[model samples]
Target: MAGGLTRYRHLSRSSSHRQALLRNLVTSLVKHEAIHTTWPKAKEAQRLAEKLITLAKRNNETARRKAQGILYTPNLLMSKLFGELRERYAERPGGYTRVLRTEPKDTYSQAPSALLEFVDSPKDVRFVMTAAAVARDLAEGREHTEITQKNVGKVTRYRAGGKGAFEDMVEKVRALDL
Candidate 1:
């Protein structure tokens, strides 16, 4: 009866256990923007993270409620999703997250490892300044350094402060010609 439907990877978990695992993974991914795990687990989590981001892109109350249902903790994550995350990926068609295979810590283990992260996340936090910082710099007419480094594979730019900081920084930098 369930024929033709794609059976998702079980990751050797029961229905409830798997649901709980995915929920926690989604929450962690949203809050931290990145997580490291074994290949199979990362792949499964990536699937769910992308879906939640897509839902967030809608940015309506219904979409917010739907995402809240899937996420484990709703307040901060839901706000981030509906606000900054929604704006960041608005132009992108899909594929809001990425899975990068990584070297395993233990060479003896056979399981592959991977890093799952949102596409917009930054690699280094120190390299970025918050919107408030940018605003302060502009208001004070301070010299601001440009982002000279290029993003390597799986190494995206980091956002300082919290919500909307990265976007705000970019806008200020552009406006100030800095």
Candidate 2:
């Protein structure tokens, strides 16, 4: 019996498979800044991603070489890790990534889903512009328009075509009494 030998989840995978899985996940997370996967996988991947980010924060030759070895394809990912991501997380201490629970893609699968992403990632920027605002800016001959986070809800509403349409459809269905 391997008593008191607690370690990590085996994930029902062989050693090589598990390593490859984590390598791919970490690479994707570093490249895309976010990735969605099953909760267990995301949780496991988070460990590796955080470790890599911590290494990136060091911004030293040894750290860069270590990250390069862990990643599958080194060139692009290593550059990103040593360049943008290193600068992005330089101020912070740790906890580089966050795991957010998301709705499952299929109803039949009970496995929980999650989104693993870097905190304060560029993709998470709240600033959103409505179609109308973009059109107005273009028509005004404005070469550069500043997008601030003030009107996020307005952008969402506009993109969703407003709540009135749904309410009107609900009222029409109620009139049918079916």
lDDT tens string, model 2, 1-178?
Answer: 6666847777889999999998999999988998988888898999999999899888888998999988988987888988888887776677778887889956898679988887656554221123334334445666434552234343333223334533343345444543
Which residue ranges in model 1 land beyond 4 Å of their true spot? Answer: 1-6, 106-108, 124-178
User: Which candidate comes out best when scored by TM-score?
Assistant: 2
Q: In angstroms, how far off is 105's CA in candidate 1?
A: 3.9
State TM-scores per candidate. 0.66, 0.66
Query: Across residues 1-178, which tens digit of lDDT does each residue of candidate 1 receive?
Result: 6666756998888999999998998899888888888888888988889889889887788988889899988977888988888887787788778787888946788679887877766642322434445555566787654532232112233323434545555575657754
lDDT value, residue 99 of candidate 1: 82
The alpha-carbon deviation from the true structure for residue 123 of candidate 1, after best TM-score superposition, in angstroms, is: 2.7
> Candidate 2 — which residues are off by over 4 angstroms?
1-5, 125-178
Determine the C-alpha RMSD for candidate 1 after optimal superposition of all C-alphas. Answer: 9.2
